[model samples]
Target chain A: MTGELAIKNLHVQIEGKEIIRGLDLYVKQGEIHAIMGPNGSGKSTLALTLMGHPKYQVTQGTISYKGQDLLALSPDERARAGLFLAFQYPFEVSGVPLSRFLLQAVKARAPETKAQSNGRPVRRPLGQFRKLLHEKMEILKVDKSFAGRYLNEGFSGGEKKRVEVLQMLVLQPEIAILDETDSGLDIDSVKIVAQGVNSLRGPEFGALVITHYQRILNYLKPDFVHVMVKGRLVKSGGSELAEELEERGYDWILQEVGAASTESAEEKGADPDERS
Target chain B: MSDHEEHLGERKSQGVAIAEKPQREGFERDYNKYDFRDPEQYAFKAEKGISRELVEKISAMKGEPRWMLEKRLEGLEIFLSKPTPTWGGDLSELNYDEMCYYIKPTGEESRSWDEVPDKIKETFDKLGIPEAERKFLAGAGAQYESEAVYHNLKEEWAKQGVIFMDSDSGLQQYPEVFQKYWGTVIPAADNKFAALNTAFWSGGSFVYIPEGVEVNIPLQAYFRINAENMGQFERTLIIADKGSKVHYLEGCTAPTYSSRSLHSGVIELIVNEGAQMRYTTIQNWSTNMYNLVTQRALVYQDASMEWVDANLGSHLTMKYPSVYLLGKGARGEILSVAYAGAGQHQDTGGKAIHAAPYTTSRITSKSISKDGGRASYRGLVKVVQGATGVKSNVMCDALLLDERSRSDTYPYIEVDEDSATIGHEATVGKVGEDQIFYLMSRGLSESEALSMIVLGFMEPFTRELPMEYAIEFNRLIQLEMSGSVG
Candidate 1:
């Protein structure tokens, strides 16, 4: 029941409305899992809940990361523990520079990497940080001038998503949840983003790519595919499952769930509107 | 003038009270060392309340001419007749009967730093005046309490026929030029505060730049308030003669106090034909002071004037520096920035009046409010009936750091001429949770993000300041932001 990022019977509510009802998901290390669902299926809720957004209340759930209770930690603490979320809609900060924000984030991730001076935090020695940032930026195909601009302010849709992937790459988190990152990108940008996400595939990094379409899955080739309907995972399979859903739609999955409930209901499976 | 140019160490050897004192050891620019407090120390202080008797006594104390005394009496009558302003911040807390109109800290005004008392010199030193003058040094003036403790112009400028001295000395030494333009720019009945300042004004700079002369370095003035309840009313007048140019910088700092103080100053500037003048003020008053200052300038044909005003600290400040473009091809610009934090209210803006054809003006106002503070921008632009081809633009941007903070904008534009072009844009925004989340996800706390945003909001104003002042302005904003957020 427990894995790298294990969620058991997770129930999340926002403003007295239950968004994620009894959803369970498990993503182990070094594996990429795809959560594909239609709109309002609570796909983004799972992403936000896992990262500990204050607005998302986990009424009944247990989320553990590396055998530690992840639900109790703050967002930043969770991030420091190697958890990242590539936001669906990244916010903009008009005044802060991108390079400065990254340097601080990098310092937060690995405080020991920064060289200290006489009893003070010596800002990570700009030359070294800039070199490392330039390397990561080049790997992601980001413009060098992006570091000088304000964070996410006046950035194009693709540019914003690219910057998110770039942040995940620079932070090098143990696990990353990309919530609908491919929703607002073109075909070429999706492949490029998938390529950027794929480059981080190794024995140490894990990712959960939350998307509405299986187009990005073609490039990512996720090890596992999940269909979340009405706040619960209805079915899950290999990458071929993504191709099948790409051909068909959620109506077939709802009919199958209806037949299964008519015969005998699964206690863990969420009934679409039975509770209401 | 030569007496003030002596070395400070030699001045110490002259058996002066300050000469015997030693320099502070290991001075590391500790800004929190505002620990010097004199509960009640004054050689001469006028009693509380302003009356005809008080005005006559002040004029007699200075031994002024009959005409000047009569002018002070007329100013006092006008001040008593006008009511307190009800449009801006609250004025009900002001108790004029308990406030001291004048408090002379030292026995006499001194042109030399060595002749200044140790208490006043130490105050200016803590505020970083001596080192500032040494670094810049076109000229420097220092005022403590109700008197100009020290005034000095560099020999290079003093020999170039540049007149820079205290206003009181200016009135006595150069009567012809000083009398011609004393009340010409801003009359006594301009406002209630201006009328009050005209009656009790003391210890401000008087600068007159000659024709075709350009002062490369800025002339600096420093003002400090030492005792409580000392209603500081300094009057500054600057005149740039025809075809001249000058830049003036003034900085003010006061010790924090539990009791309230009042600072009402009047500044009038005259820019003659083809002249240019820029006056920059960085007012860092203590939180217990109510700074109500009136500053204006009159621009002649082919002239330009600029007001760079930055207000960082005050309990309630109501200042609207104005410019009157009275000649063809005259231009004016006012860049005003203010910050209000923790029980403070900064009601400040700018005004431009076009009275001639082909005149142009611009007003850029920026304000930040935090921790229950309130900042408002009240501006006005007017064009006369025959003042054709006039163009004016007013822009105000206010940032609130917390939900409890408040901001307001009031802009008035009147164009009697059909050929006038006027534009205004106003915006108010709070520190949203989205902004905080964005920065925090990047590992910054809430206050650090707010500080950077505040600095960016005031970038236009900060960039106009000299490099040193701009850096200091950013630091001050950082300090205020730390206290207000996160």
Candidate 2:
């Protein structure tokens, strides 16, 4: 189907070793999709490849966003083209306060304001930006102090994950790729994060939520659930697929696909790079 | 075939070759803004070299007292005897006799901008000194080459027994005060550069605040070097008397030249009993400069002194602003920031000498090195014997932008007293690929992301500056970061 992100036969690698052998997925606006997989699977590879990460080499693939070839765009261009990624491990940027970073990011995406006279981007009025940031912080149950803190410098695991979602909320991209955003968070934080994602749900917004558990899906209620195994989507179904996988585990699906033996071998010899 | 004459020939050829080459468009634009040089207009230019005769000529020109002239001769002797420093940065390339010791840009200092010569005034106008003074400064002075061409103080501050003017005028008008405190904090014999400055010093600021008075606004002085092969030796002395407060700022810039120049300044401060003083310096010399400055402050009982220094755009710089806590319950704080781009080396830090009981001091330094540049933090903290209850902490952080850049920390701590407390911490970090990628994914260009990270790194130092200076500092950082990204 035509979608905001349409990946077809995508092959990706890192450091000369293939991680995503071949993958195909489509995420349309006005829809939410979740990809669940066991350890050693290439869930993060797909997310990073979608964002044009330099380390993730796409050997053979076609990713079209809004009918434009996404591979040709730089990472920043992809972001400016209404694409966002919530990293599983967000990097720490020391000294940059969260509010200031958000403001810069917002200005980078929005059209140049009329007040810009010197060719430098004029920031949104401080009062208006502060009001919006505080409102978003409140929605995520984040404390006010978070706005003044260095980005992810000394933040707790839950805070980092929440802040990733918070950035998505402030930036308000058309499509988001959440890479294991709920892995280390508590149940309450999981609910809050999901609620934050839900706030941006509309006909103009779509999301590809990558997670290991079906817990966040319970609150997200994605339109489709896909099972990713050995760097490819093995199956796609409704939300029940996640619940079924949660109860039965991936062993049943592995046996059904007749790749259980290879899966076990790869799992035993899992490339450490995939986990990071 | 003396070393000085040989180097002068080589420098002339190199300058011609550089002028012949095609300039990069972007760099030319940036360079022309600060590197434009007017014709070499000078009232007098000292002969290239430093000798007893030259020192006597400088003294004779200034018409100094017999004692002062004798001091200059002594400084000249000491400067000749001492060897050039070997550590910190490379100073072997410097030729003592290749530099013009002094260039008197104007015959007399002007109290009003209108009276200043049009050529010199144009330079200051381009540097925005007058505008800054009109907006926020309590007093302002502009120095060209070797002389202060313009100096003015607000009438209100002048009415409160505040003395602000160029150092030459200060010596002439307040010889008693100058004689009492001159060279006390940083004696000429302390270092080779200090001795050189003492021997041939020209334009700098001299400020004094009376007891129980406060100058809430900053007094600023801007120094500009106009001619190639010029050496600027500015001597500044500030006295904040008992129960007084004052803040003074100095900024320096020089036109870009293919041949190297020298800037050796000596700044001495006296924070008297129960007084407070802050001295801020933002030195952005051209990349062809060797900036060696000695700055020190003496803190009396219950007094406070602070040094906020930022160094940028020099081929090599060695400066360590020091504080001597000389009385009980005195405090000293130093905040230093350095940025080293391509072909630059910023060897800068702070020194704290706790000599009295209950004295406390803190030094925080942040440096950024990029594009094959080197930044070194060389610091010293010494607490003498019997200085009980003395406390000091030194924290240094360095950020290297690429693999080619380098950072080093050399912290020397000497505590003779067992009762003193001291702590030193240093961290060196590179701009991580993950950090850059994360910022880039948020729609910032690579350079923009890098500059943002650097600006954030320098926040502690910038936040302490006045609002306008903070803005200007950020803009300078952004300009330095542009074209740095590969």
Candidate 3:
């Protein structure tokens, strides 16, 4: 398997407050990687920083996508570069319809063709694209009337999350990062949204599913699970580590890391040559 | 000491670039000292203030009907008793007695442009009035002072039961219908300026479209104030009968005068059921003039009313065109753009009152200010108690070109019904220097980039104008930005 998304020594901050300190992670193609952490453990910060959000300041880091630097691009450029972030809260741009926005986004991502029809240049028509979109919406069980309405204006919580999944399915990016797509969904909606995400799993795509509970992990089985604590990753393991954390919680990991640091400090005085 | 009174042609003949010409310090008097010399010209015009005597005299001079004179007298009393409005733009400097209420060129109305006097024709030629009318307009009414001397419309439009003529001629020809709907949509006492217009209004457009007729071409009226200290009050009335449509455009300009002149006009539109009416104006009055106008419309069932207004010049302006939705399924739209420069204050917006069910309205306003000027948006959206299922949206965006400029949004939204939905959005920001620098880096001059950006900001408004008016609007904005640089 090859690495679809990679981050090395990622250091992120928000207004001089360091959030993600010296973090490294990777997810391969056709695999799901779940990151679990406590409340202030930089889970959402990492997700947004990877998507190139303007508010997240990356003080020191290098994010590479297929052997190319990802930090040197705008948000829209990043999205066009096959990176998608299912925002925990999507922005509502009133008066701009969803269908119109998608059309513009599709055109922005396509290269200009040199062929002309009659005296005008011809591209893929929007009508055909809309038909394909309607089929995707049917699979996701979304209301057909939402196409004409403003994007994210007056949408319910569950409906907004479903729309995010639908956007991921339509854009079909190389990498998808879900901040918290299941935070506000009901039992049935959780299943339907999970099905929508699983439909996008293939050899051409990879997904980073950020979650806080093992309930969603019952549906999405990640190949690797990483534990993040206090802005740094302390442990990495296979699928069993998720079950251990779910059963015993993070108390043991915190106690073990604290004792290890104190023991190393005392041993430094006894063996100065070994420390140097 | 503004130079709004400088004649570009005169300065150009003297081998001077008018944009870079120097001005005398502390100049306070009007530069036009030469009075009318024609032997047939009157020594003095009518009185400066409003009176029944002055109204009656104007009607008699036009050979108007008895009913028309009676309406003028009624409007005269309304003008006399009404007080100046204390709202909107500044009005502390307007003096009624200091203005010359009327001025007529020393000739009868001429149908041919070549027959007009050279001095009067020179001004029209400099303004490019005749060429634009001949090439692009369906009809053109060129008013030199207080009276229109040339009025003509295409024969094809006249054959389709579309009547386009001066208001004075409309009164003589269609007396019964003209008297019925005149001042009905917007009454004489609607505002002080409207009352003043009714009392002393001289030259304006009067258009009537018969049922099932649609004139695709736009009719235009060009008003030029040549005389010094003259007040030009033009009254316009448009009535679109069932299933008819028309687009009317009007433009104005004046030479710079030291002493301020006054412009008060009234516009009343009656859009019948299943009809559409569009009214556009690009008023570039000299910076020494005060432009105060009252315009309104009454839209019937399934009818539509659109007002595209652009005010680029004037020291002080207080004008808000309104629409009253009187029947179900009626629609109203207003796209207005205003620019205020030094010593200018533009207080302009729109009002939409929904009185019937299923009514809809949209208002988009864009304003730009620079050189310590102020631009204010004062709008209103009112939905009555029984007007259910009404939808309204208002967006106002103002751009300040410098730190000294100011922009304000004072919107009044009153919804008495539960089923009505309304949304209002406003944004105020200064020009980003990075945007200017980026455009300048591409080999374009700074002024050209600024002009292009300003035009793009007003694209939503200018795209609604007719071809000729849109071209003229671009030219006017280019002229206004000649030397406006930081």
Among these predicted structures, which one has the highest DockQ?
A: 2
- Per-residue lDDT value at B369 in model 3: 86
Pairs in clash, predicted candidate 2: none
Sort order, lDDT high to low: 2, 1, 3
lDDT of 3 by residue, B1-486 (tens): 001111212333354211211111201111222112223244337766656677788888889888778777877787778666545565666787777676554433213444333443443343455554421111112343323332334567667888877787788899898888988877776666776777777777788999989987676564322221123777788999999988887764322222336888888899999999999987766566688888888999999999999887666777777889999999999888888777667878888989999999999999998766678787888899999999999999998988876777667788999999999999986656544432332222456546655765676777787665665666556545655211
lDDT of 1 by residue, A1-276 (tens): 223988999998876778788988889878999998655677877887888777788999899998889988867778877788998888887756788778778887786865577634556577988998888788778899999887898999889999999888888888899988998798888988888898889878889998878899999999999988767888999999899888997668868776223223442234222221
Off by over 4 Å in 2: A1-3, A114-123, A261-276, B1-35, B107-153, B223-231, B252-260, B484-486
Ranking by TM-score: 2, 1, 3
> Which one wins by TM-score: 2 or 3?
2
- Model 2 error, position A246 (Å): 2.7
Model 1 lDDT tens row, B1-486: 001111322433354222111111211112123222334445677888878888888788777888888788888888889777645667777887888887665532213434333443444433444454421211112333323333334566777788887787788898888788887777888777778888887768789999989887787664322221123888888999998999998873333222337888888999998999999988866566788888889999999999999887767888888889999989999999888766677878888989999999999999888766778787779899999999999999898877877788767677899999998999887767666665555555567667766776787777788887776667667656775211
User: Interface Cα RMSD for candidate 2?
Assistant: 0.7
Q: What are the chain A TM-scores for all the models, listed individually?
A: 0.90, 0.93, 0.87
Best by the lDDT measure: 2
lDDT of each: 0.75, 0.80, 0.70
Q: If you superpose only chain B onto the true chain B, what TM-score does each candidate give? A: 0.82, 0.83, 0.81
Worst 10 residues of 1 chain B by lDDT: B19-28
